[model samples]
Target: MMAQWHPIAPGEPLRAGDQGPRIAQLRKLLQMFGDYNGHPGPVTANNNNPERFDAGLQLAVESYQRRHGMAVTGVADKATLKELERPPVDLARQLEVNAKRWDKLPDKPGKRYILVNVPDFRLHLIEQHRVVLSMKTVVGKSSKRTPDMTSKVVSVVFNPTWTVPRSILLTDLLPKARNNPEAMHRRGYRVVKYGTNTTTPISDKSIQSAARGKATLRQISGPGNTLGRVKFIVPNKQAIFLHDTQAQSLFEHHHRAFSHGCIRLQQPEELAYALLGPQGWDRTRVAQATTGDESITIKVANPPKLFIAYFTAWVDGLGKVHFRPDIYHRDN
Candidate 1:
């Protein structure tokens, strides 16, 4: 009696050295996804050498990991292998979804603009035809998600005042104030009560007494400020813009989507320089702007168009299809 063998289907995803009529079809698909625009190459069939994977295939896997902010070990571990084995059909579907989203982006080109890709956790400064600077970024959390919209750079605030949002004040600061009232004062926050129906303001002393025993106090600016040292204002209803974060350690992670509802730039000064141009402002000047006596706005001579887009699948400069995890679940 002979053992039975299963027949492989055409157009199915292939592992290394998966030979048959389907091999050609699989190879072509692999080529399409392999190194084209700084993307990784495809895996090769070298079954004889169990100790080492093919050079080209290993390179491709490593490149993919690097781009997605994954651990860059050349060996195809379980996670790497799983990603490598993603079906072509699935990849095509993601590409289509992202393409539709890209279509909705603004076509206008400003003299200088900042483009932030939320899922990719990166910000690109596009001036003329080139990307002036590229850096890692942290976007809004899933709950307080950063909205996808466009706006112009109104002004750059140096040593800006941090106004606490009602949401943060109620959920985060209030709880903390309950724990320790001095803690709020130590952090440069002043509590205030406002009229329920009107925009009537309350005095600092009144707010202090109102929140004496209760933990419903609001904090203002200082080193513990959520907005860090500086904030870049954009005229939008979303009340979103690029700002510095105290949690700098998050930037080291590849996928840094951990903000409340704003975009956090890893290197804000670099972006400022690129946006401000010619009129050079050093770190001291930037620091002054962020922490000066009052908030100041520096208007650009010709502001560049800012586009905050979400693209999970794209063909890199090398023509290879680069697929990233739909971190925001925007594809669905």
Candidate 2:
């Protein structure tokens, strides 16, 4: 039966007031998924008013998009239509995945711990198994997907310098630097030899070699740093950590999976305070620490447990089933 749910032909999204057979199919699908109750807006002779993409149907479509972690545009977008066409994976499969994750969860994930749900693009501060705070998060894209790992947040660095990753430098920055000799300096980057402690000015020829993975480039800690004003350090081999981004406007979008690999926090200051308040850190202290060009790192005696997890579908506390897109296509 699921085999027949093929994607509609590529075209502009079906917005409100649009009436067609595609809208009819969408209405049926929404009703099947419990998003459409078929009430409060309009009533036709046949009861199931499928042809019209009215306000009620638009609301249901938005709700479906929200549950599936898609862009909640209230229109039948290409991505949304594609998602509608894809066959739903069985509940048993989702339950199996959730069970494994539950088994791996620590007995006491610390008195205060941070939970980052990769697929949900959300971060929650859990204290005693109850969420005390929640915020939006921008995770990595499909190509450079954010990984699932458990670690402890040991420290927070303010005015942090961004060390250009070898992968990014080799692929993105090196080529740009080769063309413009002053590119690195203009972008607040300082070049250094990989092994030695010597930091020197970057020459045009040196930039070419660096492109070939020969040297290291580190950005200076300042207003325009990619790491923003602060970052949370979790000791991991993958070199992944939580940090702030200068682009705060991205958070306005519903589907925000735009990053290299590190998780981008929507409210970095609030998160810092949540983790550091126990250590006598406050807004005033954070401001002082972040005032200079130098990076300030503060150690946490009782670091919070950090769990980066991915769950495409799960049952909420109220027993409502919530489904999200397999953004990384991990659930084969």
Candidate 3:
């Protein structure tokens, strides 16, 4: 049976120095989640030895923080306490929900494919059912969620231009541009005729006309480009594709869900080199393509299948079950 424990009282956060029945409780709860496995039984060695928060427990707290996408400060802050307060999900229930989702995957997703686990904020490049590469990814925000779908990655574009989506242009960009008219030129953006090569200087009339579908706006290829150094094209109906980003500090956060709809990659070049294969694409070639302010495209000889999937919980190869928050609230 699970060990009986008292409730942790609300107060200041628990750090490494504090010790009491609450410390013992924290140890027990962390153990339940597989983040703490230091000793068998209670933390107290004996009545005289009472519970004491130490380095071992601190390490466990950090592990819990990492898994939950919280700041890895190794301290039991209010946020950490709040997460611990929630009743732990039964292991059987987690497995059941994950199993149902796993059943939907293809029996064989080709010899090469990319698996994006939305809730986990991770990307796994698989070859022959084995993970060859894994990287952190910034997914869509809760308001603009990344959809689940299967597509094929066909090409890699270096020094890519950013075409401000009509929706974003109207809702987000235009409003900001209105306040700062020079925002267009300063950000390497230009107003132009939709689907045409002819370019015109930015003006109030053009901006107003673009809002009415009479013109289009796109950012020039440069360092300021929001798409960063490269983009991986995955033809999908949602107009979503994987690409590099200028705002890379987001990766430092354990929980990375700060994009409009497209997924932002941490190490996109590694993926580009892998997908390009040996035919002619390599580190040196990729560097040359993205080195300057020129748009370049390299078509892969064989495109890898892309699978954007969702699963809140799963057991890893080591038999340890991992769980993630249902950011999209699709589990209910």
Candidate 4:
């Protein structure tokens, strides 16, 4: 079947009414994944336009795209084609690699635990082996990958201030903010002499001092705060955090590896309620904490265990095998 169906030539995508070997190629490719359910027969020369991309084929392509967390355009776009082109052997090898990682987990992790599959860009709240809550997550980019380690989520912090990470301070923001101090002002950051509560005015000298590692910045907790409204604290030496992000659009992306090294959640309010409920906080209390000037950190008496793992291949709820692009290249 590998040789029987190959990636459709990467050019103009195969769309409705298009016909030729490319259409036939897409037809076969979708069928291979059980995405195509119509016209199982072959496209023979004697037939009239049997290879045309029709409504059925378009629907199948949409189905396949949706399952893989891709834009559901109902066309053989480049991204879709690229995913289809993954060699079967490579997929098999990835599955084998993930199997070893999966083996590290206990047979019964717990009745309630958090599973953040980095490569999958998803978070699952599994209780009794069932997904009680699921949401899209943005992880660290490849260069600064979200760590693969297990810990316990001990608390939820709301209206959190951003103590800008050192890496981001030096690499992403320093140089620009040095010349245009307003950059820091616009983002609600206060320049403070490093290791002190003393706030410095937005001045080129202050920005330069910060850039030279003489000072630091902390973003005030408010509407446009970087950490959104809440963050889950995991007691790890790496200082890793699972937090809410103000960049809501990032969740819509199929490959959500944009953060420096934190896990950004799409539905922080929902998760906050779930995690803090046992500790006497409800939806209203959680929502209230997100506003106002005060920052709040509440400890979870029965904190859920956390498992942050990299899995490029896994089975979905419908017993269908799914594969994510090796975004972190751990498979490599």
Q: Using alpha carbons, what is the TM-score of model 1? A: 0.77
lDDT of 4 at 116: 96
Query: Highest TM-score among the candidates is held by which one?
Result: 3
Minimum summed lDDT over a 10-residue window in model 1 is located at: 1-10
The list of candidate 3 runs beyond 4 A from truth reads 1-11, 39-50, 89-95
TM-score of each: 0.77, 0.81, 0.88, 0.85
Name the regions of candidate 2 deviating beyond 4 angstroms.
1-32, 37-56, 76-78, 86-99, 195-197, 205-214, 252-254
What digit string (tens of lDDT, one per residue) describes model 3 on residues 109-183?
A: 899999999999999999887899999999999998999999999999999988888878888888777778686
Choose 1 or 3, whichever is better by lDDT.
Answer: 3
Q: Write the per-residue lDDT of candidate 4 for residues 127-216, one digit (tens) a residue.
A: 888999999999999888899989999988999888777788888777767767786798788888877878866687777788778887
- Which sections of candidate 4 miss by over 4 Å? 1-11, 39-50, 182-186, 192-215
Q: What 10-residue stretch in candidate 4 is worst by lDDT? A: 39-48
Q: Which portions of model 1 show Cα errors greater than 4 Å?
A: 1-32, 35-51, 67-69, 193-222, 280-284, 287-294
Q: The CA-based lDDT of model 4 is what?
A: 0.84
Model 1 lDDT tens row, 164-236? 6667776776666657656667776665445322222234454455445432344344567667766788888
Cα RMSD for candidate 4? 3.7
lDDT for 18 in candidate 3 is 78
